[model samples]
Target chain A: MNSTIARLTATGLLRGWRGLLLALLPFVMLALALLVRMAFGIDPEITSGLLDTFNLDTVVPLIALIVGTGAIATEIDDGAIVYLLTKPVARGRIIVTKLLVAITVTLLFAAVPTLIAAIVVTGAAGTVTWAYTVAATVSGIVYCAVFLLLGVLSRRAVIIGLMYVMLWEMLVTGLVDGARALSIQHWGQSIAAELAPDAITASLSLPVATTLAVLVTGMAAWFATQRLRSLTLAGDS
Target chain B: MTSIHIDRVSKWFGHVVAVNDVSMTIGPGITGLLGPNGAGKTTLLSMMAGFAAPSAGTVTLDGDPTWRNEQIYRHIGMVPEREAMYDFLTGAKFVLANAELHGLSDPGAAAKAAIDTVDMQAAADRPIATYSKGMRQRMKMAAALVHRPSVLLLDEPFNGMDPRQRMHLMELLRQMGSDGRTVLFSSHILEEVEQLASHIEVMVAGRHAASGDFRAIRRLMTDRPHRYLLRSDDDRRLAAALVSDDSVVSVEVDSEEEALHVQTSDFGRFTVRLPRLAADHGIRLYDVTPADESLESVFGYLVQS
Candidate 1:
C-alpha cells in the first residue's frame, strides 16, 4: 500500500465536521446502552441482547458504511482523485491504501465503541465485551470492503449502501432464513458465538460464516482495484 | 529527449466521435494543440496524458504503449484542464504530496524547488480553496513539476489567468521546453498559441488538419485565396482598377448585384492597393467585406485544399 495515498485519504476522513459528525454516532450508541442499563440493571441476557441488537447489528454496519463510502466517493465526485491516480503508483496499491483508511476509521468509530457499549451494559463478564468487540471489527472490515467497492463502482454508493443495510439486511434476511448464510450480520454473529460460547449464539456454523465473510471481503477488495484501474475521467469532449 | 507518438488514433463515445484518425510525433519542445471548442483537442491531449485510450490506434511514449500503463507516469506529468484539486490542503502540502507520490528521494527539497519555480513560495502555506484562479493554476503547475517528469502536458493552462500570469506561464513553458522537456499545451485562443508555441498541431472537426511551424501555417491561412465582396458607387470601375494591379488575381463585377467579388493571391498587397485604386479611379468605396472569415470556414478551406 502507498503511504502517501493512505495518509491523504486519512486526512480527508479526519478533517471537517464529517469526522466530528461520524464520531457522534458511536458515542450516541454507547450512551443509549448506558441508559438501558440504568433502567433495567445489569443482567447478562438483557445486556448482551442490547449490545447485539443495537451496537453490533445496527451501529457497526451503519458507521462502517459512512466511513467506507466517504473514503473515495467525495474525491471521485470532485475529480480530486486524479492527484493520486496520475502518479507512478500501481492502481491496486492505491485502492488498498484507500481501503486501509476506511477500515481504520471504522475501527475507531464503530468497533471500539462496540466494546465500550458492551462494558457499560455487562461489565466485561464471560469475556462477552471482548467477543462483541472482535465481532464489531470483523463486521466493520466486511461492511467497509463492500461499501468501498460500491463507492468506486457507482456515484449512488451511499443510497445503494443504505438500501443494502436497511432493506436487504433487515427485510430480506429477516424474511428468508436462507439469506442469513450470505449476510454480513450473520457472519459476525457466528464469529461472536464462537468467541463467547457461553453468552452469545448464532444460527450458522463457524466454517461457513467465516468462509463467506472472508471470500466476500477478498472479492470486494479485488474488484475495487480492477474497477479503479479502468476508471475514466468524464468531461466535455 | 522523450517523445510522444500518436499513430492514427481515434476516440469515440457511443456514436459521437471525439478525436478522429490522427497521427503526430511530438518531441522535446513546446507544441501547441490548436483548435476551436469541441474540436477534440482535449481528447487528443487526454490520450497523450494516458487518461483515456484511443478506440482505434495507439499512443506511445518513447515506443511503449501509454494506455493502462502506470510506469509511463514516471516520466510524464499532466495538468488536466479542470480546476478541481485537493482544496483542503495548503499549496505546499499538495505539491509535497505529489512529490512523495512520485517516490522522490528528497520530496521536501523537490516540492520547494517546484513551488519556487512557479514563484508561489510566499503563498505556498495557504489552502488551495483560498487561492485565486491564477494562484490555483500556479499551484497545479508546481504539483505537476514537483516530480520532474521529462514530459509535461497541460490542457487550457491559461484559461483564467491574468495577463501577467499568462506571460509568466508562457515563459515557464518556454524554459521547460528549452531544458529539453517535451511540453505540450492545448489552446483554442489563436493569439496565445501563436505567441508561445514554435510548432502547432491544428485539429478541426476531430481530424488532424495541419501540423508544421506556426508561422508557416499562419502564412498558409493568410495566403489562401481570399474572396471579398466589394460594393462601391462604381463597381465596374473599381474592378477595372483592381485587376490592373497584379495582387488582384480575379475580379468579378456583378452588374445584377452591383458588387465586385475579388479573389486575391497576395492578401498583404491587395488590402493596401484597394483604397488607393478606388481613390485613383475617382470611385466612391461604399463597402469592403471578406466573405469567408469564420474560423471553421478557414479550417474547412484548409481541409479541402
Candidate 2:
C-alpha cells in the first residue's frame, strides 16, 4: 500500500550479493536455453525436456525461494525491521509492500527469463514460450507470497523453504500422482498447458488449477499479513 | 505529551518469567531503567517499545495500548539493543529510508537533521558496514530520531561507546529530556544512570525493585547494613576498637585470614569513624574493601526491601 516502503524493500533486495544471486538463476536458465538452441537446432522435444525438467521444475522454485525469502528475512534477521515496525503504517501494508517487491524480483528473475528461454528453445512453432512464461509468472507470484510469509514466520525460513521446494515438490510430487495436484508447479503447468496447444503436459484441468492457484495465492498473502501482525521482534526472549 | 504506563505487567517465556508483575509510569524527562544484565531490562523496554506483548496487564502510551498497535509508533521512537542494522546502506540513506517509512514529506531534510543531531553529518555518506561500533550507534540514533517521535526508548545506548561518545550522547539525552521529551534509556552502570536520569525505575529478577529519583535509590542502596572486610596491621586492635563504636553493629576477627569482618548500619559514619579510629590508635590499615559491592547485591537488597 505504501509506495515508499515498496521502493525501500526493493532497493534493499537489489543492493548487495543477494541481487547477484537473483540474477544468476535467470542467467543460468538463459545459458542452458542458448546451448540447447545451438546444439539441438530448436527441436520441440528438446525444448519440452529442458522446460519441463529444469525451468519449471528447478529455476522457478529456486528463484522464488531466494526472492521471496530475501524480501523480509534479511530485514528480520538483522533487526532492521524495527524501523518499519515502529511506524504508524499498518502491519498488513508493510507485508503487502514487501510482497510487491518480492513479486517484482521473482518476475524479473524467474518469469521473464523463462519466457526468453522458452523462445530460444521452441522457436515460433509452439506456444511453449508464452505457456511456460505465464506459468512461471503465476507460480513465481505464489511462491513469493508463500515464501515471504514463511520468512516472516520463521528464522529458519530458507532451510524450510528449500526442503519444501526440493523434497516436497520435486521428490514427493514426482513419486505420487495425487501429490502433483497439491503442487504449485503443477497448477502453474496446468495454466501453461492451456496456453500451449501441444508443447506442455498438465496434470489438472484449467478451471481447477485456476481456482486453486487463486485460492492458494490469496490465502498465503492473507496468512502472511496475519502472521506479521503479531510478529514479535527477535532478541526479546 | 506521550507517557508510557506499565500496569502490573508480567511476561514469561515458557516457564521463565522475564518480567514479573512490574508496574511503572514513565513520563516527560529522561528515566533510566537500571539493572544488571539479564534483569529483564531489555524485556521491559521491548514491551514499552511495542515490540513484545506483556503476558498480563497492560503497557499503554497516553491510554492507547502499545502492543499490536502500529499507530502508537507515531509518538514513539526506539533504539533497540541489538547491534545489527541494514549494513548495506549509507548512514544518511538508512535514516532517509526510516523517515520515508514514517511517511515524512521531506525525508531528505529530516534525515539530514537527524544525522546532524547525532553529529554524524561528516560520516553520513559512508556505508554503515564500514562504521565503527560508536559510529553505528550514532547512525542508529539518527535513524530512530528521523521522525521526531515524542517518546524515545533506548536500550543500552552506551554499550560500546567510548567516554567522549558517551558524554556526547548523555548530553544529547539530557537536552531532549529538558525539552520535555519522554526519554527512557536502560543501562546497568550505576554512574551512567545517576549522571543522566533524574527519575529511575530499578528492576531486579524481573520485578520493579525501586522507582524514584536517583538520590532516593542511592539512599536505599546505601542505607542497608554494609559488610566490609578490614585487613589491618593489628586486626584485634581494629576489631576491638570498632566493636565499641556506636556506628558498628558487629565485628568478627577472622584470625585465619588476618582480617576483621565488620557490619555497620550507618555506612557514612562508620567509613570515616573506622579509618579515624585506626589512625588515632596508630593502626596501619592494609586493606578496606566492601564485602558485597556488586550491583547484584545492591539490587538484591533493594528487591528484598
Candidate 3:
C-alpha cells in the first residue's frame, strides 16, 4: 500500500462534516456509558446490556459505515478520484491503502471508544470490558471492509449500508437463528461470548464466526480493489 | 517520442454511442481536439487517458494497449475537465502527493518545479479550497505536470481562465510541443485551437469530422457553400450582376425580405468581388450578412463534408 495515498485518504476521511460525525458518535457512546454508571452503579446486567445493545449493535456499525464510506465514496461522487486514478500507482494498491485508512479510522473511533465506554460503565477493566472491545475491533474491521467495497460499487453506499445495518444486522439477525451465520453483528457477539461467557452469549460457534469474518473481509477488500481498477470518469461526454 | 494510436475505437453507454469508430494517431505535438459541445471530445480523451475502456477496438501508446494498463500512466499526465480535487490539502501538498504517487525520487523538488511552472508558488502553501477558479485550475495543472509524463491530455483547460492565464497556458503548451512532448488539449473555441495547436482532430456527434492544421480547417470551413443575405438599393440588378461572376453559384431575390439570398462557390473570391461588382454596376449595397456563420453550422457542414 502506498503511504501517500493512505495519508491523503486519512486526511479526506476526517475532514468537514464526516470528521464531526465520527467524533460525535464516540463522544455520545462515552457520555451514555458515564450516565449509565451514575444511574445504575456497577450492575453487570446494565453494563453488559449497554455494551451489547448500544455499543456493539448501534455504535460500531454506524462508526464503520461513516468512516468506511467516507474514505472513498465522497471522492468518487465529486469526481475528485480522477486525480488518484490517473497516477502510475496500481489501483489495487490505492484501494488497499484506502481500506487500511478506513479500518484504522474505524478502530480509533469505534473500538477504542467502546473500550473506554465499557470501562467507564463497569468501573474496571474486566472480562466484560475487554470482551466488547475485542468484538468491536473485529466487527469494525469487517464492517469497514464491506462498506468500503460499497463505497466503490455504489453512489448510494450510505443509504444501502444503513439498510443492511438496521434491517439485516439488527432486525433479521436478531429474529432468525440461521441468519446468525451470515451476520457481522453475530460474528462479533460469538467472539465476545467466547471471551466473556457470563455476560455475553452467541448463537453461532466461535470458529464459524471467526471464519466468516475473515472470509468476508478478504472478499470485500478484493472486490473493492477490482471495482476501483475499472473505475470510469464521472459525467457525460 | 511518445505517440498515441487510437485504432478504430468505439465507446457506448447503454443505448447511446459517445464515441463511434474513431481512429487517429496523435504524435509528439500539441494536437487540439476541436468539436462543439456534446461532440464526444471528452469521451475520446477519457479513453486516451485510460480512465474508460472502449467498447470496441484499442487505444495504444506506442503499441501497448492503454486500457487496464497501469504502466501506461507513467507516460500519461491528464488534466481532466472536472474541477473536483483534494481541496483540503495545500497546493504544494497536493502536488507532492501526486509526485510521491508517481514514485519520484524527490517529491518535494518535483512538486516545487511543477508549482513554479504553473506560476503558483506564491499561493502554493494555501489550501486549494481557498483558491479561485483559475488558481484551482493552475494547481490541477501543477499536479498533472509533477510527474513530467510525455503525454499530456487537457480537457477545456482554459474554461475558467482569464485572457492572461489562457495566454500563459498556451505558451506552456507550445513549449511542451516544441520539446517533443505529445500534448493534446480539447477546446470548442476556434480561436483557442487556432492559437495553440499546430494539428487538430475534430469530432461531431460521436464521429470524426475533420483533421488537419488550422489553415486546412479554415479552408474546409471556407470551402463550404457560403450563403449571404445581400440588401441592395436595386436587388434585382445586383442579383443579375452577381450571376455573371464565376464565384457566385446561385442568386435568388426574396421580395418579402427585399434582399438577394446569394450562395457562393468560393468564399474568398465572392467576398472580394461582391463590393467591387456592386460599385462598378452602381448598385448601392446597404447590408451584407453571412447567414450560416455559427460554429455549429460550420461543424455540421464539416460533419457532412
The better candidate by TM-score, 1 or 2, is 2
The TM-score of candidate 1 is 0.90
Candidate 3: where are CA atoms >4 Å away? B230-245, B251-260, B272-287
lDDT of 1 by residue, A52-111 (tens): 777776788888888898899988888888788888899889878988889989999988
Clashes of each: 0, 0, 0
Error of 2 at A128 (Å): 1.7
Docking class of 3: medium
Evaluation by lDDT, superior candidate among 2 and 3: 3
**Which 10 consecutive positions of candidate 3 chain A have the poorest summed lDDT?**
A228-237
lDDT of 3 at A138: 89
Give chain B TM-scores in order: 0.93, 0.95, 0.94
| TM-scores for all predictions | 0.90, 0.95, 0.95
TM-scores for chain A over all candidates = 0.95, 0.95, 0.97
- The candidate scoring highest on lDDT is 3
Please give, for residues B123-232, the per-residue lDDT of candidate 2 as tens digits. Answer: 99998899999999989889888989899999999998999999999999998898899999999999999999989999999999999989988998999999999898
In model 2, the clashing pairs are none
Candidate 3, residues A1-237: lDDT per residue as tens digits? Answer: 789988989998888888999999899888888898999899988887788888888999999999899989999999988888887788878888988999999999999999899989888898888998989998999999999999999999999999999999899987887987878988988888888988888878888989999999999989998888888883566
